[model samples]
Target: MLIGVLLVISWLILLIRYPTKALPISMAALAGLALVASWVLWEENRDARYLAHLELRLSYDPQQCPGDRPLAVRLKNGSDAALLELRWEVAAYRPGNATNLAQRLYESPRYSGPGELLPGASWNDCLPLPDLRSGYRPSTLEFRAERLQGQFIR
Candidate 1:
């Protein structure tokens, strides 16, 4: 909003100062600024729009044998964009605890699908515990994918 106001004010000042040249210069400048602003807005929001359709699920699976990955992971993509990669931040907390006891990051090397995760595809797998501490059990688990830097095919 401020930018729009400033641009208008500057254009008006230029028009008053140099009536002949101001029209062409101001038009060119405004056109360039508009193009740059649109590109920036599109780049910033494209990822978020695609990621909004991603569904993630996590659980602690004790049935898995010890020394094996115990965190169950299920991800579904409901958008039309194909995801080239994904990363998640996992957090574990004791029951009724506000503070997390452990945290880890998981990065998917490849999609379970034949290629990049296509639209409406799902991936299921298990992840290792954040820590190797014996008898560690977290009643509360959390997953965050805010750092999704993956390539998307629209």
Candidate 2:
């Protein structure tokens, strides 16, 4: 921040003392600033579209990896940035019928680890589910990361 201010002051002083030479410098700086800002905004906007295209696949055999989720999610970085600080949610619910509404049974905390989700790359792992009664089923699951969003419904 200090360096940026100093650079701006220097540039302004040059512009005042040598107007012709400083015009090119000023133009170049403006172009560079616009380029950086546009790039940053593009990246930020893309984040809102995260997880929107997340793909999911599963192989469940309750018999294997008991008390565990059998779900796998694939995230293809279709953007120009890396994803980090990723987390997810797993929810279990009892189907609703008659006068009963869907009953929430389990929800996991933000699960995170195993490095940054990079551009054009993917990360995957299986997480354990809480012991549950037969009446409940894994209902909805979601994942989040920088500019990412995805959910699985069963």
For every candidate in turn, the CA RMSD to the true structure comes to 6.4, 9.2
Model 2 lDDT tens row, 8-43: 899889999999999997899899999999998976
Top lDDT: which candidate number? 1
Per-model TM-score versus the true fold: 0.60, 0.42
How does model 2 fare in lDDT?
0.50
Tell how far residue 28 is off in model 2, in angstroms.
1.9
Candidate 2, superposed: residue stretches over 4 Å from native: 43-50, 55-64, 67-125, 128-154
Clashing pairs in 1: none
| Residue 87 Cα positional deviation in candidate 1, in Å, after optimal superposition | 1.6
TM-score of 2: 0.42
Could you tally the backbone clashes for each prediction? Answer: 0, 6
TM-score of candidate 1 relative to the true fold: 0.60
For candidate 2, the 10 contiguous residues with the lowest summed lDDT are 145-154
